[model samples]
Target: MERSQEYENTAWASPVCDAQEPRLAAAISGRRLPCFGRARPKKIAEGVGSLNVRSMTGRSREVADLMKRRKINILCVQDTRWRGNKAIDNWEMGTSSFFSRANKEGREGVGVVLNAEWKKHMVNVNRCSNRVMSIKLMYGKVTINIISAYAPQVGCSIEEKEDFWEQMDAQITWMGEEERIILGGDLNGHVGRNRNIIERTHGGWGVGERNEESENVVDFAVAFDMAILNTFYKKQENQMWTYCSAGRKSQIDLLMCRRNNLKEIKNFKVINGESVAPQHRLIVIDFEMKEERRGRQQQTSRIKWWMLKDQELKAEFKIKVLDRMVEAEDPDTWWTTSSRHIIEIGEEVCGKTSGKDPSPPRIRNLGVE
Candidate 1:
């Protein structure tokens, strides 16, 4: 519903049916749904859900708090004031950050950040326009492609936008079909504008209706096999608006990706914050990445088994368990009775050293078999 509301600035045709929106694969139209800032306010909770936002400047602390409290996994920002030296320096500890904001002089900008845990997989880094940057992630076999963008404003004209995509598309073409490509940021084009088109997620599976340039962009995404996430609001009053300049609100900011790739899109909502917060609310979304489950399982099992071994082998473990205890020349590093199970390792070692059978044992003289 709110997805269509971005058209409020101009009159739009009757909305398209949900089954007719653009599809990455012809038969998978249903895979696409209302995207961030496109779905209606009612479709999503006001201030709760996972999210990635654009344009958070001088607000790293507040953003960090929000991420920790909400556990946000990814963040893409555009026009953030972050600059050369101080950009990464100011980030909250424990967050992996990639930023390309306006240079110290402040011309144009873009950036991205993720949970610090994601640092392991950071792969490709691309900077386009002063306002765009693309990052590739590899989590084992799973890949995530994220881009932060700031499209040109009205004064910049459609040609600028046309040029913008030309360069961007050229840069990211190496991405794989299976990769999850997300392009989001301060896309200045308004919903349903002559150049900014709004279409339904269900019907014809192509851009709903376009002026000329709009359709071209849509065509490119389709050619690239990308799906534009749809919205919940029906282009009516129950809006999914993001900008409120001149006392008129409209949808602008957006998050997009291959339609079928989002595992389970629980929903999308706008978090209306305090007056001090940006007028554009945070568009929170809940999506499960099915592909990540396997690696997560492997990591969990690996870590569980690893730490388990490390703990049981404490008698031989050189790593200090407690900092204060390290200086004490502790008699037994792994001797905690709580961890008596590790006794098997010690007994095996002892039995071998004393020339005793390993399996002959009674509990009292464990070293002997």
Candidate 2:
């Protein structure tokens, strides 16, 4: 009976109970077990959207409200038709809107809007041209570049289309490999539902038939190693289309991101029943930004060894430790058992020091006084 009780009280019994009653094992062994309930790494879920507002003349508040209602963090609006290159902050709506437009009104214009949460992280805004503009934001260690573009329509001259692509190519080529890029725009082209030759850039979920303008979009994606997000998700015709006009529907507005970052995208779809614009619907993509975990500094506690100077306390500790002592077959077991008992008894007899610097002893200056 004595040997059985001794064995049950030793560290050997801890392993069996550790799997079942971890708290009980920890108490019996006088050691703390690792906690498995640590919090998971945090992730930032951001919704980036694109819309052709047609004209954002007196509808800034309306656009801001739409963004807030839909929980969109970043929005790229094309054909804003706002003159000059400047930024507008709507305090009541909690959005920062930036636009780049031609000197004349009612013409080509592009803009990007950020919610209050993302506005503080904005590094700079590049107004490349009336048809293209970009905003750079620092998200932890990653740099996110969001470009808003308005490509020329089929009715426009060949030179106008070429110029727009040239500007887009320049902007894309300027971005570094490590930076994350999300291009949203009204490219006014259809990539179609086929993924035969351009499968690397097109995701095969596109709508309608490919056109001449579609080649420009696909070739750009292939050259830059980007994935056209609109053609990646399978959705119904209504959910897939971004534009609706005089008895016609099309998916002209599009979103694109780096091919390597496709895994970060969670969902992409067009929002229906939204009346932000008469012809265009809002298309959004949900993606996650993983926050880097910071290393924690280990905290240590120091035992108050000097408390043993109290003769009565030291005697009590020694007696308690001697009472708990037991013979062990091995040196390791003997040392561990003896040390644990000694430390336990010492803690009971003499308290520990707080992990802080103690006040200095009063200085004696009898001679100086």
Candidate 3:
């Protein structure tokens, strides 16, 4: 299931969808994500209603699982080295994405993705960093802007850090104050290892002064009044640290909204397996979506597949497939709660349904054991 990033397969994304991906075989070749976190935004759109955010830590298979979970809507990643021409279906039943991969074939790049059907409503503005993707969303005719960002390693000099801060300042200001904005990603900066009480502002960790680059991000967040939800980690000891590095841990990846109604972080394995080879864990964000597709509609694409016969028009049929799966027989046999758990990804849909009395599922045909 290993895919490549190149001039062709523009819609191609990460390699984390399949466990068979050669990249994750750490014992095989080069550093899995050596040039991962340095790319810039490649594609964009407006109205990204909901998303599943994560610092991929260079695993595409996990990215695919997150897509299938029906929990988070969009995903943000960092350090995705040499990612291009990767397959979306291989990751999830129905999923499509946009991404900026490592710049030098095995180095740095960045990208973003919206289910094709939802693309028309949103538009993306270009900036620096495969680390950042800005989406303009229209909620009930109300516009909301979101920026998915990732800062660089704190190894740069103070002068260089100042320059990055200036650029970050300009990009954020460009969003303007009129619209609602939610900015999330891995800042890679923390106040300190210990969650000490902050007298001034910010609840959780702040960026460290490893170098000037990180200091700039920390200072900017404080100046902008961006609330760090993970600050409340002390409130919920169970949820902390989106990634574990060198055996030490810290909450590097973040999810910050303009207005904080931060309910609860979904789970660690939202889009990944239970292994730790990639070095990072998955993070999911769940908030109210502005709008939901009410009925069946038509969509066209350039992708090809077993279901899509047309050479030009490609349609995501995952939703339709799951709907049928649920209605096949004693719905309760293969269902848990409700069919509302549908995840309409790129070209397909997959999800677990809930029934009144949920006790997992007991399916014989599909081998539910």
Give the root-mean-square deviation of each candidate in angstroms. 19.6, 22.3, 25.5
* lDDT, candidate 2, 166-216, per-residue tens: 999999988899789999999989888988887778888888888878889
| Local accuracy of candidate 3 as per-residue lDDT tens digits, 1-369 | 236554456664556477556553223224444454454322223222222233345555555554445434555555555444222321333455554434435443344444544444565545464445566766455455656565665664667555545656766787756555666666666544333333233554333323333355456766765555545334333345455657766556665554332332222222234352344555554444333335644433321233233322233454354445544366775464334333233224222333333343443253222
Ranked by lDDT, the better of candidates 1 and 2 is: 2
Question: Each prediction's TM-score against the native?
Answer: 0.55, 0.68, 0.50
Off by over 4 Å in 1: 1-57, 84-90, 96-98, 157-159, 193-220, 230-239, 274-277, 292-369
Tell me the spans in candidate 2 whose CA falls farther than 4 Å from its real position: 1-41, 91-93, 291-369
Query: Model 1, range 1-369, lDDT digits (tens) per residue?
Result: 776776675664756676567654333234464343432212111122222243456577777777667656666766665555223623687564545646676655677766666556777677666766777888666777777777666677767777877866775687777677777666654434322333322223222233243444456455665544434323433345655556766555666666665444555555566232456656555655544444322111111123223333444432322322322245464455324443444343332223233233333432322
The local lDDT score (0 to 100) that residue 176 gets in candidate 3 is 59
Q: Which ten residues in a row have the lowest lDDT in candidate 3?
A: 41-50
Q: Which whole-number lDDT from 0 to 100 does residue 106 have in model 2?
A: 54
